[model samples]
Target: MFNDDEKPMAPASNAGRPAVGFSDAGKASVKAEHSKEAPLAASTISVLLDVSSSSSTVGRAPLDLVVVLDVSGSMRGPRLEQLKSAMQFVIKKLSPMDRLSIVTFSNKSDRPCALRAMSEAAKSDLKGIIDGLVARGGTNIEAGLETGLHVLADRQFTESRTANVLVMSDGEQNHGDARQVANPHGVPVYSLAFGADADMKLLSDLATNGGTFNPVPDSGNTGMLAVFSQLMAGLLTVIVQDLHLILSKPTSPDDDLDKIIKVAPGDFNQETDAQSGTVTVKFGDLFSGEVRKVVVDLLLVQATGSDYEADMLEVAVSYPDSKGVRQKFRGQTLHITRSGAATSVRATPNLVAENARRQHAQSIGAARELADGDDLEQARDKLVEAQNALEDVLDQANPLVAILRTELQQLLDRMESPELYKAEGKAYALAAELSHARQRFASRGDVEGVRLFATPRMDAYLKQAKEFAENPDAPVPNADEDAEEEAKANPIALVAGSLAFYIRTAVEALQAIEKIVTATAAAGNA
Candidate 1:
């Protein structure tokens, strides 16, 4: 799980570098053990491709948004009010260039308003429509989605604009086929599962088609607003769209592109042309400061008595800028050398640590599933296995190891305390879900905010920690002398402060790693 204090990678100070970068586990140099009689040798190479946006401010694209609200019987009081507040917040953030549509569903779907530009008059009219919303009947998610799609499709496309649907629901879909409703239509459907009863699987399926799924926990109206605001931030800052990576076939006759693994932006659709020996991967939209990473594996076979340099693979990237202008990056080559030398260089520590983190995430996910099934012991064992694996590759000198170790220990503690685990099980589950989401799609900064909102208690502690850090001389609260004494004995304050310290340390370590990588790359070029 990501800590509250762990900040995302800051933009590189240098501006000449491309936003996207490619690296590997190590230089693809393999020492061959072939003798006079040996005919062939085999080895595998791993490549990591990272795509990031520069920190510079860019023009904002106009948005065509469809707000789908579920006014079901379950959402009668505070839930309905919170939903209304969230919608209004979104409205305030939109500019005149953006167009908005409102769709409400409860056994049936109703489009209260069509796509209208965010003029003062339009905002007033939408607020009136939102204020009149009432909760009743069943949940017709299909109707909500279909109506949203209709609104979006009806709009005429303008230059440099993006469109999508935001579905906010607090219950299970009682009618209609949500899957059929979410067919490919160029526009993605971002779904928010409001409250515990919201059908996560249904919303996940809807968003998986082309968008993201967020679970809005029942943590009152404030939490609702936070989640909505975070989503809006992502929508408003999209810097690149329709990003595609094409991997051409290797030039070496003896080598083959074995596999392509998407290590980040969790759920992406990829297609391959068997005849052309080419692979195409589609990454939807990238917000500024977001990074998308992927790894490709290649298998190389060398004929006997041959020492040669082989072009392992070529990667070409294409995407549209915020202005809808197409930009292409002509492919770069990854070379591998087969040598008779006695030694081969080891993989870089950063690459090794990244791979370990990926594996750890997978392990944590598997353990969560087992725990959900009431197999706590097995879950602990799985996590223990993961911890051991991480320890094998991570040395004491690496600061990340300590951070990771602390996270694992905290999770293990949760599992061991039955009372604590039962009380905070949902929060724990959500933390895992959010962690996986960040690993797959959300930007690092986005994940930090979302995770804080989703876990109320943690958020409170983190906030308190920040306050304390900013004003160390401020007096601690106390109701009376006894209360003041109790406050002094309280572990919560200490834990919160410690968490803040750890988070700062972890973030600094990550920044140091980035600097090291930059320096190493420059040295290699020199």
Candidate 2:
């Protein structure tokens, strides 16, 4: 665990908007040791972009959301009540500018509420519909998703908006193929695995194109609420949209065009401009405080004569500002010296960039493949190999590396037995991959590593929600609980604070029970 004093990365001076930074792992040299005629060398470089939230006078973008909720038999009892409580919180958070629709699915799927702006009256009606939901019949996830798409498709596309689909399912699909449902609008689809019976692997696959897959370990109210809170944080904090990153050689006629021959953009959608030879990666939208690392391997050709400087590559980024005007940030030119001397040269690696590269690479997928093939030992060996490399190159004390090493170790522990691997190892692997690949903090609906991107307000709400769910009747600590002298000196102030705390808790607990009672009564009526 990282100490409270430590940070994941150094704070960027450019705090408001996304800023571009560059570093090379090592320099490329032309001459090989002990030989005059040697093949050209290759080098790896990384471009790290800090996507921080801009100071906004206007609030978050207007949201067009569709929630596909599961009403299967498995979701009855506490499971459904917990879900309703979370949904209430969600409805309470949205503004009038945001539009929402609710789609419920079981043996069949239907929309209880059509897409409408979150007016006060509309919110009340939605809450009523949410409380009255009854869980029954088989799970038709395919029908749910298709109906959701139809809802979005039926809406007016005349305006620029941020749209998404939220999928909550606690059981396996028994009706049709959810994977085959096509999303013509290309809206991101965030999924939640509500309980143990959920098909995590399938949900992970569905969220691959865009969006994230969050796991809620069980039907516990706190976990459910935390997942919903995290989802809200992501939806309301998109700072950059239609982000485009372009990579190509310098345009100078004298510059060496042949220096960079290939570019591999891992898992991101890319298009190579044949005429200009520039690779453009489409990173649709970035949330507040998110970090995206673009690492590309470059092959450099060595000059025959003396040492000289050569341009490696240039990176440029573009995104639209709030006023709908395009903004561009051009990265500084990267250069390295080419040496022709017969002596061997050693290149110093940039530990930070290299570590980021390894984390984003194929280790998780490699292990998953081996484990799926029944080669459990090889899967464990693959993780060990990755961990060893990380240890060799990175300082073990670094906060980021320490956290990563700990997670890797946790995965390693699961491979000790086939029974263990079958139970939860695979889920851990998927979570780690999603966390790194998408550069978001994803886990089993726990608060671990959530502070990485969660704003202070959201963080406080999550901690409080978790604490309340764990022990609703627990007393709130006095403001000066640890400072005995201060508490004694300010007895009157302490009494006032305690009174306020109790009042808040009483109201919140009453509200929770009210929702539960309403749902229970509705179920009994059916």
Give the top-scoring candidate (TM-score): 2
| TM-score list, all predictions | 0.68, 0.74
Query: Which TM-score value belongs to model 1?
Result: 0.68
Please list the C-alpha lDDT of all candidates, in the order they appear. Answer: 0.58, 0.62
> Best candidate per lDDT, number?
2
Q: After superposition, how far is residue 295 of candidate 1 from its true place, in Å?
A: 1.0
Tell me the tens digit of each residue's lDDT in model 1 across 219-311: 644555655665665565454566677777655454433444332334577787867757777877654345555656555554446464445
**For residues 1-526, what per-residue lDDT tens digits would candidate 2 score against the true structure?**
1011111121111221222221110000011111112223433333333323332212234567789999999999988988987787677656555678899999999888888677668788998999899999999999998888777776754144567888889889999899999887678888888776788788777775457777776734567878787776666555456677777887544343353454444456888888777778777766544545555545555446655555556666666654556666453344555555424433324435344445534786799779988999999898888777675654455566666566767778867887777556776677667766766656544545433334443564466456645764454221112123233454443234224434544774575466569768979999
Q: Ten residues in a row with the worst lDDT in model 1?
A: 22-31
Error of 2 at 288 (Å): 1.3
